[model samples]
Target: MAPNRWLRPEVYPLFAATGVAVGICGLSLFRHITINPEVRVNKENRAAGILENFAEGEKYKEHFLRKFVRNKSPEIMPSVNGFFTDPSRN
Candidate 1:
């Protein structure tokens, strides 16, 4: 009965603080690994079988945004681009 009373108001802040601290640490670690090319190039950071192949290892951590944008057609606005380039538009 008495033990249950300790679980009320004061513990919420402690839980919130712990969650925030964990989020901050996770974000910091991610940023550290991402922006630091030295970390990216480290052999240990790469996938297991790819350790000997630097170029293949790079594919493992290549940013999702870069992968999405790669080899895409250069049209900034497809309809407008077509309007300018199409001989029929003239």
Candidate 2:
């Protein structure tokens, strides 16, 4: 009995290539659909000017701690006092 047309060796590579191409396109589409445009833009803007807006080392440290670290842990709140202290004397 003869093998089916799709089962032929020549057709197998074509099918494999098409399957790989479709998988790549599907993954690209999924990533675009899942990302939030506003968040992406905000991240880009922050990367561009994050340091320029907070030139002082202390201000930048305080802003980061307040935004990300303070709410993350109860134990950190007490030790965070050191972050606000005047660094010139230290």
Candidate 3:
């Protein structure tokens, strides 16, 4: 007998058809889950909107970092330094 003879030829087509059906169902389900309805509707302008949001976030992050550094005083420095120096504090 052939190595693959354990599965009869008659059942092979059934397995192939089942696999194709399952594959199509899986793809449809995955698309339904991952795709946002709003994004799908405005697909034409999605890239531009995403880029604008990303740029806005970067500007906010820069402003926050600058403000944080400018507001840091000498009084708060010692506590920050001591936290790292003393191992027993852990």
Report the lDDT of model 2 for residue 71. Answer: 58
Clash counts for the predictions, in order:
0, 0, 0
Ranking by TM-score: 1, 2, 3
Global lDDT of each candidate:
0.74, 0.60, 0.67
Model 2 RMSD, rounded to 1 decimal: 17.6
Candidate 1 wrong stretches, greater than 4 Å: 1-6, 41-90
- Which stretches of candidate 3 lie above 4 Å from their native place? 1-6, 38-90
Give each prediction's root-mean-square deviation over alpha carbons. 11.4, 17.6, 16.0
The list of candidate 2 runs beyond 4 A from truth reads 1-3, 36-90
TM-score of each: 0.38, 0.37, 0.35
lDDT of 3 by residue, 1-90 (tens): 775675888888998999999999998677555553324345575655544356645554466458777866656578888899889899
List the pairs of residues colliding in candidate 2.
none
lDDT tens digits, residue span 2-87, model 1: 87776788888998999999999999798767764445556666544323566645865586867998988877898888988899
Tell me how far the alpha carbon of residue 82 in candidate 2 is from the true structure, in angstroms, after superposition: 56
Pairs of residues clashing in candidate 1: none
Candidate 3 pairs with clashing backbones: none
